[model samples]
Target: MRPKIYLFGDSITEMSFEHGGWGASLVNHFNRTVDVVLRGYSGYNTRWGLKVLDKVFAGSSESESVLAVTVFFGANDASVEDRCSAFQHVPIEEYKQNLHSIVSFLKGRWPTTEVILISPPPIDEPTRLLCPFTENKSGLPERTNEAAGNYAKACLAVAAECGVSAIDLWTRMQQIPGWQTACLSDGLHLTQTGNKIVFEEVVEALKKKGFSLETLPVDLPVIFDIDPNDPLKSFQGI
Candidate 1:
C-alpha cells in the first residue's frame, strides 16, 4: 500500500482540500508518491479530539505504512473560558496533556510514523467580529491572539516533550508584516497565500526527515516508462 500522511485538526484542516488549500497543494506536491488523508473535525477541541482518537485509528494495521500524522488542534481550545464560545474550551493545561496523549497514541500505534504538531493560528479578534463565524451575542471576540499564542506555545512544548517535529504557525505568521490581514480569511482560517505557507512548511518538515517528492520513490513507473508495445510487462514485478 502507498504510504500515508494524515492531517488531523479542526476546521482549518477540515476545509484544507478546498480550492487553493494546503492539503490540495500538498497532494499536488507529492503527486503519486504518497497518499494524504484528512481526518479533520471542524469546531473540535483537543478534548473532543482525544475522545475520538480510537475511532480515527480503529482500522489501522500495526504494520501499515503511515509516513506521518499531524496533530493540529487548539483553536477552539483556546477560546476564552468566559466567552460564549467557552463551550468548546479545554483548559490550557488539559490541552497540553491531550496533545501529549495524542502524540503518544500515534507513536505507540505506529512506531515508525513521524508525528508532527501544528500550532493553532492566531486569532484576528477584529475581523472575527465582522466575519461572525461563531454565535457571539456577547458583543466581544470569543477568542484572542494572546490566548491563541499560549495554545501555540503549549503545542510546541508538547512537541518538545514528545521529541517530534512541530510547526509554530502562530508565531511564524505574526513575524511577517500585515500577516493578520494577509494570512487569514475569517481571522481564524487560512487564505490562499496562508495555505501556501502551510504547504511549504509541511514540505520542509518532510524534507528535513529525508522525505520529499524527489527522494521518495513514486508508486509506479512514470507514463514515460510505460511501453506501448508491451505495457503489461512493466507491471509484472511491481
Candidate 2:
C-alpha cells in the first residue's frame, strides 16, 4: 500500500491555485498512489495550527500506514507590524519555543511517525522593498529569509536530535533557476508553476526515501490509531 502524507501550514499552503499546491500536485503526480492531505489554513500561525490539529491529523493507520508529514509555518508567525505597517516576522525565540512545543507534542503522540520541517520560501524583492510597512523590518532581505532558514535548520537539528527527517525548502527553493519567478509571487506563496516545481521536488525526495507512487491509492482515507479525546490526539500523524 502507498504511504499517507499530510501537510500543515497557513495561506501559502491554504491555496493550491489552478495547478494545486505542492500537496495536491503530489497526489496528482503520483496518480492516486500516495494519499495526500492538505491541511492548510490561511492567516494561521503555529499557535493556531496546534489548536486546529484535529482536522489535519485525520489520515493514517497501522493498517494503511502514514509515511510522513511536512510542516510549513513561520510565515504568519514572522509577520510584524512596523510603523503602522504589518510584516511577517515572528520573533526568533518565540518561533523556536512554538516549534519545540509543536514537535514535542507531535513526537509524543506518534512516536513512529516521520516529521519534516519546511522553511518558507524567500521573500520577493519588490514586495519587501516596496512595502512601506515591512521595508524597515530588522531582517529586510537576508535576515528575513535567514530567520526562516534558521527555523528550518533548527527543525533539522531537532529532527536529527530526535532521529527524524527534514526538508530544506528555503535552501532548495533558493537554488532553483529563475526561482525568484518560478517559486514565488508577491514575496510569498507559490504561483501555479511554483507549486508544480515543489511537488516534483517532493516526489523526487520521496522516491529517494523508497516511496513509490505506484503503490499508493489516490483517494485513500486517513486512519486514527488513538482515542479522539486525547489532548495529543490533535497531533496524531502530524
For this target, which candidate reaches the highest lDDT against the unseen true structure?
A: 1
Kindly list the per-residue Cα lDDT of model 2 for residues 73-102, writing each as its tens digit: 876665543422244455656666666667
lDDT of 2 at 103: 73
TM-score of 2: 0.71
Best by TM-score: 1
> Considering summed lDDT, which 10 consecutive residues are worst modelled in model 2?
80-89
Enumerate residue pairs that collide in model 1. Answer: none
TM-score of 1: 0.94
lDDT of 1 by residue, 153-185 (tens): 999999999899999999888876888789998
Regions more than 4 Å wrong, model 1: 226-233
Global lDDT scores for all candidate models? 0.90, 0.64
Q: Against the hidden reference, what TM-scores do the models get?
A: 0.94, 0.71
